[model samples]
Target: TILGLWSLASMSFGVFMGRYVNTEYMQSYWRIRAAGSGLSGVDAAASEVASLGDEAAIISFTEGTIVDDRRTIGYVAKGTIYCVAPVMRRAMPSAPVEFWAAGVGCCERRSNFDCGSARLPGGSLTALTYTAEGDKYFAEAVKEAASVYSITVGKRAQRVFFEGDPAVFIDDLWREAVVAAILAAVFHFCTCIIVSTALQKAGVRWVGGARGLLPGDELAAEDMLLRGGAARGKDKSSTHDHLRNVLDPRASWVEEKPERSCLGCGPRHYWVFHSLEEQHVEEIEKQIWFSESRTLDQGCDPSFFDRVVIAEDGGFNEVATLMKSINWYRYFSAFLTVGMIVYNICYILKSDAHMITSDDAGGHMYLISETVIKPPLDFVLRMLHIEGTGRFNANVVVPIMEIACLLLVLVWVTVLAVEAALVEPRSRRRWKNLSRVLFNFPPAIAGFSSMSLLHYVNPSVLIEHIVEYSHRRASLEPVLAWTKFVVLRLLCLVIGVDAFLMKFRMTAQYINQEDIDMRCVCQLAGFILQLIGIVPVSIIVRERLLRAFFGGEDASEDIEEKAKEMTYHALLCREMYRHSQSDLDFVVMVLSFNDVDFQGLMLNMNSSKMGPRTSLEVKGNAQVTKKNSVEGRKSLEEDLENDFLEVARAASISKARRGARPGATTRKPREGRAGGGSPPSPICP
Candidate 1:
């Protein structure tokens, strides 16, 4: 596919060059240098360049890549900068080469004189193909595309310039080669590619790109990449936005992994979320499961749960600390919410007098009792039948109503503030914790506050939090979200009518209808954006909100399921090693996995930890058995007595023999083969 794409792009470039292309543009560019070419040596070129000025003559290729965006060559020589082929301002920088300032060019255009240094005496373009392949394949390409040039520049300087683009036959091969390939790809695999990418982002395991299958260790564990059996190699600072890459003890640079031949290999291996074949599906499931386990290890490895009892004991305080640590953003949210409520109230108060007429008859305030107060006021007005009458004591009544509303906002904000402060310990510096809360007050005063509560939390922070609580404690979403939405609802109400009371200033009388409409749209837009964003983010975060809220063994089961899925999600999202050691045994012990289906996997990890009963308990038991073996001790004593008696008898016999044969010559040493036979056996009962 990559080759096809490259070929297609190459062909597109070819078609662009053929038939309709203006090679004259390049030639003309060279023609501009014609003014300087007439001069001889460095000084002459310099003088001519000065005379021509900067626009016509090339000054610097500091910005040009060796192979420029237009696939034209550029370089810096002495104090001169040259654009060998000058045109195609819209082109992108080509792939780089070891030599030259700008990287090498990609599109093969007959540049009149792109490589001024390499041009020959005759003003002609020269194509240089320098590859270890010895240019055998491209030799013909060179002959047809361009001629070779060898230009020499003396230390004394020289003025050699190209005149203009030369005439040439248009090449249309790019149509059949490039167009066909590109169209075929777009027609056949465009949707597939997009879908695959989307699924990959959603934590689905897939294999392609002509790479080998399941190359473990090549990828970081978090990515859940699989290595091709012992084969082809492969595979952030911000805490909120980054994946937990540091969790793995063993990490290696992905570049270090040996590249695998995906298409060139004997057979390609792949793992898909849902394979066409059931066997493939199962294999992918295993890979997914394996990857998932490693991903989980990034945070709470199963080891924590394996020793659940111990962890529970040690972790109690940590939990308290984590939950108690105020999000800080929440405080800001409350502050903003209260301020919004206050602003709304003030707008109502200021508008209380009534609508003023040019005729000088006092009237009811404009936009004063629209959304919240309209229903109650309308009823009273209807009963009094003074709906269209001039202003009454509404000025006096409205301030009291504003006070009530202000009081409610104050109470709500105060309660939230107290709870947050109480739960949060004041271990950190007062000022440091207050920084986020202190958020640009001047800016807020100048209408710089976020329009929505969703904006209050950083996207990264939200994501990290979502992932962090994926399988754990209950979410405080209801508590956290309600106040903000209430603010939303209030704003909506304001917009539903034409109050336009977004940030009511005490001095301001009425909000313009347009301002209200715009603010309302922005709020709606923000909501829509957040909603769309969560679609992808939710896949990655996968918080078990239900399990978090509902505490039970059933919820625990769901949590376990979510944990595995999230682990898999991490594998897909992160670029990590394929094979990381995970305590699958511990997972089996704690998680309610279908043992019948996972028996083999469970056994695999279980076997790794299985050898013998060597725990302290087992050793203590073994020691006790030895101490209680009375019969065995008696037998040991008998055996020792027999050995001693034999030794004593042999010593006595040696003494008797020595006494009888003091003069006897020492006997010749007897020769015997090892294990050939024992001495002649004496029959004994």
Candidate 2:
């Protein structure tokens, strides 16, 4: 969508530029042919050229005036070489000069004219447009040459002629228009293919499109195994009864192992399932139930939602830290946005629009009338209520600011996109610090806000001209504005619709997948709205920050305070997710009896007797591949007992020492610590 809009904008700009150039082509040049020999006709044409204001004339001089191997005067100023050769009536010591044939970079020697077809037969020069600066330079060059050759010249004879035709200039304008249209087409299709392919691969399907079932769906489908027992060659009643027995909590036996042979600890109870298949079936059912229940339960786990405030890791600490590290870029973007807004606005408000002017091939004055001639620095002056207008060109200054802002925003968006879209929420503990930044400043919003910076800093010539021209030309503004307005809002609408289509498939984690799509859709949207939305996205972001930290009061807070609040919010979410996962794991383990029941079975099973408890235990331990030999089982039991005793004794000693100390209380280990070691055994006192 962004590419389509960009293409349309490019094509529109090309058409506008082409039309403007064509109009100028009709009025900007005159065909002034020499009437007689010896430079007389050239002089007549130069004198009459003043009537056509801001227009150039092409002068075809007579062959008699052509001077082969003529001495050309070259003057270097502002890093541009201005060259001119004298057009004289005759080659005499006192010969009067008609005019100077002018062109840039046409002289090999500072003193000789070595440029173009001036020395060829039937050669001629084109007249240069009148300008105060160009006039001064020509006068200076003529003066410098007079001192060396001792030839007299006056202001009347200072008329300059450039060595080119105006027809080529018109051709270039049309060429630019055609090229721009072509480029826009290429960009549009390429981006469409890329975005479409990515979306398809990521499982974003159209409505009613066929797709493989999710993990949760497959588990839910397993209900058919019991419902249609004929598929498994079993009676439906028996299968139903078997499933019910497996699901019943009382069906699992509870065994209490005595302390003496176990680990010198008090008796501990463990669940034991009837058979391995029953345990496996129970695990699947619990998973399916959890999945179904979670869909209905919008609330987070009570352990997470019941908290009064978020922890440092929960949400706010990361936001706080990230704001500090990234705030300057945000501030600068806000400033740039303001400057651009003002520049664009003032262009509309101000009378006598300033133009971007350059010299064409014919040394004719080429003007880009649709440009903001007043720099951003000028706006700064107006804001400060300075005495005079600011002349500093912000074109150079603003782009530098843009570069700095772009780099920061680019890095921030990249990391955030990767974390939110690629990294799992639970697995993000390893990337906790970086993940905090992601949550605080979502990748979608960050990219959306910085879209202008991306557009402004882009080196695309067509976009550059469109931006510059759109501000100056009032006629172009409404059309351009409406086009962009529709494009961006339409993009939002498309994304919103796509999200709706995938609503059931999208989890909290997968919601981050929309970030890339949002970035692509909304990136150019910023550039489009810069004029209309005077309040930058940064300012809005700042407002959100203030609300999060200071409860929406119009009050200032320290960076550290904001940082703390932000990271606190981030960590709070993390903590909530942790609790939710805990609930899910608990639900699955309790029904399956795999977590605790296996411990008792491993401890009490006798290798010699194939009794009911021993047979059930053997069938339940599906993960254990090799049946332990009688000697191996006895040795394993002794080793497990010894290790359990050592851990229990250590925990007991630690508890005793804490009790003996003054004002020392038992402290639980921090949640989510990596490799904190298996929590003290439940058997420990």
Each prediction's Cα lDDT score? Answer: 0.33, 0.41
User: Which regions in candidate 2 have their CA more than 4 angstroms from the true location?
Assistant: 1-40, 44-56, 67-69, 91-98, 122-143, 146-153, 156-685
Candidate 2 per-residue C-alpha lDDT over 1-685 given as tens digits, one digit per residue, 9 for 90 to 100: 3347756866776677656544543223222222111122444224443444333344445435554225567778888777766766444435655466666676744556755555655455443432224557777777776765665664356454444543554344455545655675676668668766654433322111133323222322253342221223335454334333322223334333333455544332222223433345564444335433332232212121221332322332233232233234444544554455444333222210111121211122221110233455467788999966844432222323334554575587567656665667555433454435433333223333212323332235235445534544435577776577546544433332322222112122234452344443332333344323323454345445444445424333456666655554345445434443354432222222221222222233234333421122323232121112245344644543454345446646865776644553334444665666654423222
Clashes of each: 35, 26
TM-score of 1: 0.23
Residues 149-184 of candidate 1 have per-residue lDDT tens digits of 222222322122222231221112223434555665
- The superposed Cα distance between candidate 2 and the true structure at residue 164, in angstroms, equals 8.5
With candidate 2 superimposed using the best TM-score fit, by how many Å does residue 72's alpha carbon deviate from the native?
A: 1.8
User: Which candidate tops lDDT?
Assistant: 2
Worst 10 residues of 1 by lDDT: 240-249
